[model samples]
Target: MKRLIATGLALAALAVPARAEEIKELNFGFISTESSANLAKSFEPLIKDMEKAIGIPVKPFFVGDYAGVIEGMRFKKVDIAWYGNKSAMEAVDRAGGEVFVKTAKPDGSSGYYSLIVTHVDRNDINDLKDVLDCAKGYNFGNGDPNSTSGFLVPSYYVFALNNVDPTKCYKRVVASNHEGNLLAVANKQIDFATNNTENVSRLQATRPAEAAKIKEVWRSPLIAGDPIVWRKDLPSDLKAKIYTFFMTYGRNGTPEEIAHAREVLAKTSDGWGPFLASSDAQLIPVRQLELFKAKVKAENDDKLSADEKAAKVKEINAKLADLDDQQKKLPSM
Candidate 1:
């Protein structure tokens, strides 16, 4: 009887599941939209607020480029991140990331625009036509490859649609973040560069002298707001805490608290407000942009044989059509 009772107890213990380890810290990654010092200063208040709300150490992860943050999330070194629509799409597809919220404009605008900018002193280069003229041997500054406004939008609208490859369209081509590109243009380091309206507005507010030296040469259509993403496999309880904190951060609390939260948010790079509930679906428009860009590239490629190019174009068209259908079904934001 004693042996049987011991056997039963052992079996019961074997049947019980082990408790999962509790998360001790959260690492939030930020894309290198600007200098590290500037980004740290802008996000400090929000970071402190998040740490207090989540009851854990919240560390800020920064790198030289957007890809680094996506990779950090892929390896589970970063638990959350702020990603432009283009980078967020990459994170969702490559990393274990899912968009949980998105920044909202203070005035309730739905999106922002990508811009082509030049130094105000450059009377010779007034618009997209002059930049694309390619006879002046003008140097160009592009945005980070993964940036939506900085790279993708302008790449599609300015270069791709015009069938001019940026590498060959200028005397020199370089890649940098929005801030770097903006400052470069203002300082006349590069004749022109890709930037977005948000960054330009921020610079205008902070450094009017610099902003005054820059002029918009061209602007792309509206692009979706940036997204805040987290690892999909994060602990359910932790996810809940994070979700609650973000959804309520600036939108909730007393009048004083709300004002403070709004001020902190306004200091950030893009000067956005309380986050809105978002999901992977928020990336649909960006995905469509990507597909359209790909389609244009496929159509423009000169090396491919007639049949090969035709087949590739057909495939891209199919993808674009699918995206269009998906977009039609989603509720309006």
Candidate 2:
């Protein structure tokens, strides 16, 4: 009888699944586009506000680059993150993350362009071609490898398409964050660098003196807005709170309330309007860019015969077409 009772108790315990630990605090990670300390300071107000709204401690994790944040997510060290389109795609694939919201421009646009920039005072570097030629005699700055505007757009539209590698074409080539690259150009520390309209607008609004020093030499087609991604497996209640806080943060509030939310959001996104509901499908443009880049590489592969290259390019194009169809079916904001 004693053995039977013990066995029954054990069976009951086994039948009742262990409860999952509730997330008490969130580690929010973002790439350091500026000094990490400065970035942290900039986000502190917003973090505190988020903590208050969600009733949990919100910790900021500012990493050196986009990869650092992605890896942090992969290891489950980061609970949520801000990501560019490519990095957001990476997080979804590697870190079990999904986009829940995106930053909106003050003008309500959901996208901005990558730009090549030069010193405003330089007559010799008046155009994209001139900026490319400047590389022969001066240092050049690119954005970090994970930067969409800083690296990918320029690589595809400016360098690879033109059959020129900046490393080989320039006296020296270096990579840094967009803020760093822009500052280098503004300070005349680098003869040329890549920036984006969003960052440029931010600089203009916050640091007009620095903004005055640079001019856009060329621009790429609009890229998707930055995304706020969170672990897909986060508790449903917590997720709901996060979504509600973001979607309601700056809109349809009392004047003071709306102003406060806008101020906090501006500090975070360099003058973004507000947060809008978003989803994983927002990353389709990035995937399409990846596909286009692959197609370009396959078409230009020297080892492949003309027929082989043509076939490879055709395959990539077909994939891109399929991607477009998928994108077309996704809900738009």
Model 2 deviation from native, Cα RMSD in Å: 9.0
Tens-digit lDDT string for candidate 1 (1-333): 334334433433443343386889999999998988888988888999999999999999999999999999999999999999999999999998988778888765657899999999999988888989987888999999999999999888898889998888789999999999999999999999999998999889878999999999899888878899998777666776787788777777899998988898888776878777777898988888788888888887889889999999899888888988988999875
- Alpha carbon lDDT at 20, candidate 2: 78
Instruction: For candidate 2, give the lDDT of residue 240.
Output: 66
Query: Candidate 2 residues 257-319, lDDT tens each?
Result: 889988777776577777766778888888887887777777778999999998998898888
Against the hidden true structure, what lDDT does model 2 obtain?
0.81
Residue runs of model 1 more than 4 Å from their true location after superposition: 1-19
Number of the top-ranking candidate, with TM-score as the measure: 1
Kindly provide the TM-score of model 2 when superposed on the true structure, using C-alpha atoms: 0.88
CA lDDT of each prediction against the hidden true structure: 0.86, 0.81
Estimated TM-score for each candidate: 0.92, 0.88
Q: Show the colliding residue pairs in model 1.
A: none
Q: How high a TM-score does candidate 1 get? A: 0.92
